[model samples]
Target: MTQIQPASFRDAPFREAQFMPVTLDVERRNDGTVILRSRVELGEYEPNLAQAFTKTAERCGAKPALAVRNSDENWEYTSYADLKHSVDAATQWLIDNVPRGGVMVMMISNGLTAATMTFAAYAAGVILCPVSTTFGLTGGDHVRLRHVLAKTRPDVIVLESNPKLAAAVVSCAGDDVAIITTDTQTVNRRAFSLSSVLATTPTSAVVKAIANIDPENTVSYMLTSGSTGLPKIVPQSMAATAACGQQALVAIGRAADWGGVIVDWLPWHHAAGASVLRSTLLQGGTLYVDDGKPLPGLFDQTIRNLREIPIAYFSNVPLGYSMLVEAMEQDPLLRRTFFSKMRLMLYGGAGLQQHVFDRLQEFAVAETGYRIHMTTGYGMTETVTGCMVIHYPTEQVGIGLPTPGLEVKLVPQDARFAVRLRGPNVMRGYLDEPEKNMEVFDEEGFYRTGDLAVFSDANNPEKGLVFAGRQSEEFKLSNGTWVYGGSLRAALLEALDPLVSEVVLCDDDREFLTLLAWPTAHASDQPLGTIVNRLRDFNRTQQGASAIIRRVALLDQPPNVDAQEISDKGTINRRAVIDGRHEIVSRLYAAEPDDGIGIV
Candidate 1:
């Protein structure tokens, strides 16, 4: 077995941190473009696997599945017949190439091969594992690539031939592992060209064989964003992904077949991206694959795409919404179509900026005359999809009440903590590491979500959960009134009212609460008096155990990347935040109590 170290993967793209988890398969990814040169045996779930596949395929057949925008957006589609045929050919291809489930590692951009391989792997019975091209794009991604490869022990590595990654892939590959190039025009070292075979393969008999496999067996392996550690190789049961779509449909107050067209790009490696694709395919929904990156250039293009297509729903990160609100406010026709037929506008990945929320609310009042459903969907790759979703018309940023059939328990995050979830969607445990697996679920088997939250209304239990920050953000003070950093952070976000991007609460057990804010663009250049007045107003109506910002320091840096302060996934390491502002923190405490004349 080969192992990759932290140093080799140190400066990886997407995340900059130490790598963890040793995947058994290291070489190839299941890019759906290949013909499986293997067997299609019904290892298990023989009873209902065909039925579920039929149902899922039938759903896909009703609508044309359009993936990748611009050039690769093949409006051309395959019916249930075609999907089955493609699956069959791909399965046969896998068997012919590397039978008996040798891992096919896929490290490519988000496009057809990355998308289609998901179904083909299930058809071929090969272990389908995909890695983020983050390493190739940014270089340091090998830390995760190494970790995933080591743990998974893949036999064949399939990669896109990009000039930048050519040297790195060769340098990083382990011996005996085959490297295949897809659509990139170069083939070497047991390499197979993807497009060449797709044009010639016969899939009729292959799809017939795949009918025997069970739905519960591992279909594909997805990795997390690895904000905390290395990206974990998360497996989803075929049943779980399908069920998640059913639950998400219910959460959105729409029929399973409600004219859904998903618009947003959240990266395919994580839960949000994969689930959106699944949800659309299962519901016969059209997916407008947005080229937006949540940053200005990409997201602006998304808005343009939305206007062209009759998008039924839009989902993205907090930054995306903030930028989108600016776009909506700028255009009148865009605003009309934005709210029209738009049943769900979902936010996940990270916290929604309060400013974005306010602008959305304001936009609803002006454009549609009624507020549309604004929601927060929550889950990890381990759960296969979001276990909870904030329902529409529910104000504030909530992860929403638990989806039907899911159970949630408030595990004490810190002394003042309250957030955890468990259910059918919970993962079937990690790849290995029993000790670590044991920590994920409790005595009752609820998945321990490390988030902190407040009951939306202390009076109303069923409303939803309001996310505070992470538990470690809690800071105690001389007063012993444990400042709930999560609650304080929420209050700061609430207090700023649609002003800041994301809030990081500062409490070192100090005398008062200080805020390290990542400001929203619209609120960027506002006057100091206006900001001070806003905080003072917030303090007026503030209540117990929550925070009242004594002072707010707007941090100019983007979300901590390079894992120096925050990881690539945007989870602020509280330690990084506090230490980075040591001197400022000291001064805040020294002047906490009436700076002039001790309250004279």
Candidate 2:
């Protein structure tokens, strides 16, 4: 094992005394490149994912590491010792059943079995690939799943015992690859039970395999949903993933000695879930897998979990926090329990609205007697999880300074700057696509992030970068003003809170912005007259042409996965919105708009 270096928190990126006790060191090269790196040292380790779990297990021992609700709707706990034991057992099973250095594609949901299996694969040096369980045989999800299977060409696939997922994997895997299911009973004779594998005794061969594994080996092939094309497989090294975990711990200002708890439902298919799991495990913290999502009829499950367990750190998309705010308003007991032991509230995937941010702060202060620290970060699968995170309190939305190992360069494009990042956290390149890789990186090898951003304080890089929308999504109006879709969408979501669920900003060669919005489930109960009146009140405060919505078209159906409007991670694909629904957009500009189109 390599001796871990001590992190230097003295030179943190932000104003040291204002926020979390974390800092970074920024240096400028003579070649006009600025480099930002984390000052916090990651203490000694073997720089392997499996080694991380082994050390955490020894330290945490009998402490609870994971919690999941059983079929009976009760919490079942897994201690660190139990986790290590299970991982070892499962590791031996993989060694026996799978060829060395094979791919282990996971198609299971968030649970004890799924979590253990993923770690066990890493321990045995299998490349872990997780696919969203929501992906079906049809739609854009199917296209993504197929792309993943073709790229990784997995040696084995793990999934729930259900027929739906079984069929999906089988269709993608064909007859060559082995299928492992969680069911005890065999519905498909070819499918092996995951329990049978877990029952295998530990072998020295597995131990030897773990010792021989290389930190530079690709540990995972995380799929990224390209905004313009099919999902791309990111070959992530063991060292990169582990480094990301350390960065996460530093970004949150978490002490190794003070282990915390997290309640999360984000899918393992995405980088966010993997980052959270790795960070919690490395910090010896507990993770309670909440099955609830931000979508309608699902957030209640999250509320139920929160009502029972006190979370120290909370992470979610802006939409999830919005739903949570609505729930907290209705239930006083929930408000108290949710914020009882809260340390930090983190939002990602997109910029949060000012209204939603303010509401959460109010609730936290009322319940916890003070305003809790609310922060956000910016990164993608290419960066493992986050390259830049806000470590301190900010007045508005700004992704905080770069962590210890990353280098962020801002290249001028349009009115804003396109963010280019390079570090251990970033992937080496896209799998098997040399041309695509060339297009994404510059002459200096910084990965070109398609998104644009602006520094919050031009004089002070420590203040961080404000996300300016995706480059492809931005379009010019007839008046020649470029409208940033991401910022506009966030503003509309805030102003139309509790009424609009999602918004797609459409304008190119048009006089003003056209909003194609999906009403909240609650909005379905209100009359069209009521909905239009609410928009009228929201528009009254707006000043500029870029901010004004000349026509509002209420969508009868949500963005469809088949049409490519909804990505596999459930985020709206902005280009798909305009291209998929050209008819709806055209109607908004008709001489006499339809009843569904409200003229402002």
Candidate 3:
């Protein structure tokens, strides 16, 4: 067993930024329940998302509101004024067609048009439901798409002009639902062109619709990842969405200055991506909709985009940061362009490995003589994005304290605490699911997050909290030893660095633990003996049965997005993968293991 060194960022200069002062109000109940809230009052925020966009448009009409890569591989910019006009026209069309408060399902990818339609739908008082394009594009059966359609019962379905999507929509959507495409050519009888919608003359009705928007009214029906079961629809209100942005502002301050540039590829269907979109627009910043992703084939486009566009703020999942680190390590020009103007680097969706954080700091120090401030936040679809953030400067990874206007309740659960939240940003309940609503909230009206956390410094309440794992994912073995899946996964990832890209723990009700891992790209070139030796080293350091890995199997295939084994945000659906790949799990726990299984 070897001693692991603690991360030290003292020598590295942290990039300067305006962070709002944090003052937490902590209350310890007689029953050992702890309540945490920020004392710094949340200032005024926009009443509705429509008003926010309108205000930004008026403030910076000539500034680029959104940009997308054209077919020629050059960015096509859309000014705030131009986008406002388009949104007004689209709003007028929606007022004429769809009933007020009707749902409009968006199945389109991120682009200037998608951005326009999103705000237009908000301004027109139409509840927007943005779903993953993979639902319609991939998975031959379109099971999830049909399920979403059934749940939403949308009046209009808007998507990019693709024959496959058109066919899928026609098959799943009701005949009464109108289908809109970007192009003028319609593939189905009920289809309409986005061009026609945008060509509609803006009347006083559009202005009136925008003015009539209520902060309490539902703005969007955000869908959960459905990792454990079917995707649940979370109805986000205008006030909640706006409050999320204000929370970020008061907690971590602005990611960039006014009119700053942001390049991102996070899908708009997810809460984090939606927050990024809304926050950027509200702050009067330019958002360049990135077409690239963190996947192997698509990440190259991300590198290309970063090379061309100097971003003020960058955010991605841990895996995405891992890929970026590899790219930046190889290309000096890429590092220069990426770090030249980047004020902050934020990671979410998963725990970032300490090695990745260390390497990024080294690169940052080399590039600009200052380590870019890296932070993370904790939230979900129900919260309209991150309601808790790592606002202050610190080297360690943590979930941080609750943002202003949010209350966090921590109930004792073994050594950790089960997290529950109550905030203006938090959702009232899942859409029309009274049974689930009852189960999700407690008697005090706190939204039960089902997440486990421990204080970073129990003696100091301001140090924030560290995520332990999900309560549902924690399972007891046959021997009655509980395995904290989330914390264990994070630890194993750090221990097997540069070897495994991701790992899933198994043997929930069995005697011991096993792992199914996806190898890193470089790991494939390494000898099997080397990977086995690393696992043996990690196992030797563990003292308890819960922490020990008895065997490991390298997965040949990645988590399939079409099968719902992985989410658009790159989060692995642990239950989905385990259920979907029973055979693989069985092989890992066989009585007489094969040569491929690395026994420790």
Candidate 4:
């Protein structure tokens, strides 16, 4: 065999080789699936979360891994040793409660039943179908529960021990699946309580689960309630979760008292908890659970928590940042307290506006005598959390390149072929939906990310990637000229400043592209004409026939909620907006000055 020497960049022969520039939204190809042949100790992995707790109990598992609100309103965390014993006892009780391998309807309040046992089941080696207790509150919730029951067909439905809530669960489950209650009491529901399960005979029944179960063992299933169509059951695996944990930890750097104290209230059913919690747990680190949302009334509490934690890394959807910027600009100690611990402040799960980034830069420099790293990460649940994370300095606004394990490909999308990615972090498939799964991954096995991106610094590929926009939303006019809604949106936002929080580009079949500008609710002081004039200025920056936006409206209505699928990250759901805006879009196409959008 021919001897091949190691590859090094220092060699002149490799100096000319081109690597993609890094940007906030861009993706780059870098080989494929990773195999750790060299035992370089990349780090520990709870490949099967089932065995993770046992491993942690032997190591740094908290005295109580499960947390609960005390009578005094303080949140207390449970240690690992006790949690393990509880899980084992619970497993033995559940086995006697329901048949082996039978599905269990897991739904209750946002407490332990929602967060812990649910996770415990996966670790305890049972199939747990997680559902929302909120589904029983509204007509929509009932309808959703019906849809879920038909699909999962669980042998047992577990309701939180709250008596009132247990009654709802029993009524929902009916005579079909047996109901098991936790801690709370429910009327008319014949069931076993988790507390009773914990007090099971033979307290040491041994809850140790088989760690090497088939990857597709169907541990946890989450339904996607996206606006577009019927919900999807996104089945999760040990591989994907473990992969996501490793990927995020490598990039974010995890260590106790070292990593950021993420004070987010994002739902655990989504990717945020999966990626964030998995990474933190793998490092035996701490995760501060926040109870508030990003809304105005809730902002102060979050700010207080944020100030106290000294976050090393923090992320919020764009709207959250817009508000954070306001609160940050108003306070001095908050800035000192914030930047004091915040090393990397990231934004994602939606499109980020430039003005928010600028405000962050101002706050960081003025208070800390340092610049905070403002960045964005892009990935789908299928892609194990995030495959690409751009940690560009506050000054740069682009999403950066992919980490070492991923690969990207961009085909024009228009007459100009654009870039995209194919990587291992990409999902295996959407549970049992082979037909749907085939479309997501190309023949080469790369996940077809619907996002469009450009080179942050094309001259040097390694610099990073920039988020261009949704490829599906980019279009052209009768002039045979292309309108990059994303590129143009970026330009308009840069010029419009912070007052204009979000913009939806219109005019699909019309002559010039239009906009439905959602001004910042706090930006009431800015006049409509000023924002319009700024749009005109932004349009002027474009050259040739592509420059457009004959009319613009500042919408009083916030972005669509259920009907319009604005991303959880706060990016405008272009397709949802265009679909729902049949009339609003019509007026914009007709150049109706009374656009659904308006200036502050």
Strongest candidate by lDDT: 3
The residue-by-residue lDDT of candidate 1 on 1-600, one tens digit each, is 122233322222211111111111111224311111111111222223334455666666645554455466433444445554555555677756666555777776655565555556666666777676665555565666667878888777768777566556655667777765664444335566666435447555455546666667776677766644676777767666656655566555362233455665766666767766666655555555666666535567777776666555667666677777788766777777776655557776666765566666566555544555666767777777786766535556676666655655654434333555655567777886588888877776766766666556655555656776665455576678766665566566667766676766666666666666666765767754566687887788777534667766666666544434543333456666677677655655564533311110
**Which candidate tops TM-score?**
3
Worst 10 residues of 1 by lDDT: 33-42
Per-model TM-score versus the true fold: 0.77, 0.88, 0.96, 0.79
The TM-score of predicted model 3 comes to 0.96
lDDT of 3 by residue, 1-600 (tens): 121233343476788876767688999999899999999999987767897789899999999999888899888899999999999999999999999899999988998778988999999999999998888888478888898899999999888788777778889999899888875354565777888988999999988888899989999999998887768999999988888888887777565553588898889989989887888888898999888888778889999999888887888888899899889777888988998987888888888877678877777777777878888889999999988988888878899899999999999988889999999989999988999899999999999999999999999979899998988788999999889889889889988887887889996788999888888866878866677787778888888999888888888887887777778888888878888899888888889988888887
Residue-by-residue lDDT tens digits, candidate 2, 181-209: 76735334366777787788998886787
Lowest-sum lDDT 10-residue window in model 4: 9-18
> Model 4: how far is 271 from its true place, Å?
1.0
The clash count for each model shown is 49, 12, 0, 58
Model 1 misplacement above 4 A? 1-63, 71-87, 99-102, 183-188, 203-205, 253-259, 351-355, 411-417, 472-483, 505-515, 527-557, 560-600
Misplaced by over 4 Å in model 3 are: 1-10, 183-186, 478-480, 521-525
Q: What Cα-based lDDT does every candidate model obtain?
A: 0.60, 0.77, 0.86, 0.60
Candidate 2 lDDT score relative to the true structure = 0.77
Candidate 4 runs further than 4 Å off: 1-44, 61-73, 97-111, 128-149, 156-175, 178-194, 197-206, 223-227, 254-260, 391-394, 410-424, 475-483, 507-512, 543-547, 560-572, 575-600
